[model samples]
Target: MSPSARRRQEAGGKTRPGSPRHFLRLDDLGSGEVETLLERAVALKAYRRTGVDHANLIRRVLGMIFEKPSTRTRVSFEAGIYQLGGHGMFLSPDDLQLGRGEPIGDTAEVVSRMVDGVMIRTFGHHRVEAFAAASYVPVINGLTDSYHPCQVLTDLFTWYEQRGSISGRTVAWIGDGNNMAHSWIKAAVLLGFELRLACPEGFEPDPAILEGGASHATVMRDPRAAAQGADIVTTDVWASMGQEAESDDRERAFGAYQVDSDLMAAAKPDALFMHCLPAHRGEEVTAEVLDGPQSVVWEEAENRMHAQKALMEMLLA
Candidate 1:
């Protein structure tokens, strides 16, 4: 077992399983910490932009566990850690006993013993929570059925880079109220932003999730209305991972919610366009709008690495 793992097991920071801190959700960090993190992320991006090398995490190791396939999360994290002078080991359920029905906590205990931190992209939120409860190191929620915290964090960081603080800005969310929507709700509550979510009736965000953020968010049926005067127009696919079976129905239910030129026109003149991506053109968003002037998606996507590097530094430092 790694020395860090043995230390964690023998003594949690304050006698709790999550004593050192975990990024399982956005709420895990307070507003001040969030602000500090965003500033650090921007600095890291600029610092690396000049091709300078910094080895803050020299010789550290991070264990990345993915139960779902990813193009952005995997690549961004792998590249980010290497750039920070750490090694990231990618693991799949099939690579461990978790696929063979081993309890999540048991696997977490075993892995946290060998790595400096653990990042999990899995199907269930409970799975991530359970793993964190047993993990000896910091655990990051790469993605989960109920929340995509890391992606939203990167989005917020991108918005901060172009605009200013997102505290009072109006953000319109169009399409299925899935994990991305849920994570946005958490951000709204934490950062005091007005999140106008336009999702179809049956596809509305979980009431329990919205309830906590009710003061900062609104649920609307008309996508255009939500986008009107908004400072940011964002969306996600009608069907997320594992919901492919509902694609046909979701396509019908969400057809009217697409962020096209018309909808984009409803927002502020300089409103930013964002998508958590793997976006389906002509579906949740139009090809024109996605490729248009206001779209900072490529920058937003690239920020994932910078933002996550800052997050890793926050926890691992």
Candidate 2:
């Protein structure tokens, strides 16, 4: 057997024979798996809090490819691998032949031969899929225009740390209907939560993803309506990286949708606020709410490393 296949067998064949598991999206993990992951994140965090040692990924290597730049995604994954005693290799488009017309499959084959796993953050979700399909090692979707699953996984783990079970909680998502919103939709479906999204008239989340969480998700234009009695209130930037052209228009349209103290007050008294940074204090959310006691943005951000350490262990250890 190939090294990757032999490792999977040693890990107990958690997936079908001859197939490596890929965390390309949140739904890629079953609800039970989600719970386990969150729980693992908690345990890992606790272990670290007491100054324990964790080197599960010793001698392993993760290849991280970035087509889109990010502050948190890059730092968290690299730090996570290092903390777990593994090496993380960062590759940008300029550093790889794939940027100059090399086939994705060819690059995937070459990379997987040397690395234990790969993580990709790119414009198109399909690129990660193509990589996973071709590689012998496991793959992770760091981010895409379609979804940002790892960020949401860290959010869920943070929520679990602060509020315990999220299965019956209400999460309010205010602002743009972007990749983060899509990931939240998948999270609601998998984790059994109520997800209410507030977006402008033309900014609804992808219909297919909205449909996937039909039973537990709702969308409307009223931020107050969505935040009412919510257990967690979250949002992303009004315009993501590539949408700079629409910045002015989006700012106008999303002005009223901001998650300010007034809107946050509509949620439960102990509600936690979340934003996938780097946040524009006065744009998608107000300074008061983001910096308030109820905000867990920093902890939420830090959990990315811990949560992903568990994720990498699941796939590569």
**Please, what is the whole-model Cα lDDT of each candidate in the order they appear?**
0.90, 0.90
Give the runs in model 2 whose Cα sits over 4 Å from its true position: 1-17
lDDT of 1 by residue, 176-277 (tens): 888999999999999999999999989989899999889998999999999999999999988888988999998899889989999999999999999988
Q: In model 1, which regions exceed 4 Å deviation?
A: 1-18
Give every collision pair in model 1.
none
Instruction: Please provide, for model 2 over 1-317, each residue's C-alpha lDDT reduced to its tens digit, 9 standing for 90 to 100.
Output: 87645544555313345777899999999999888988999988888789789888998999999999988989989988998899999999899998999989789867877788999999888888988887778899999999999999999999888878899999999988889999999999888999999999999999988988899999988999999999999999988989999999999999899888999889999999998899999888889999999999999888999999999999998
Candidate 2: Cα lDDT at 181: 95
Pairs of colliding residues, candidate 2: none
TM-score of each: 0.95, 0.94
Worst 10 residues of 2 by lDDT: 7-16
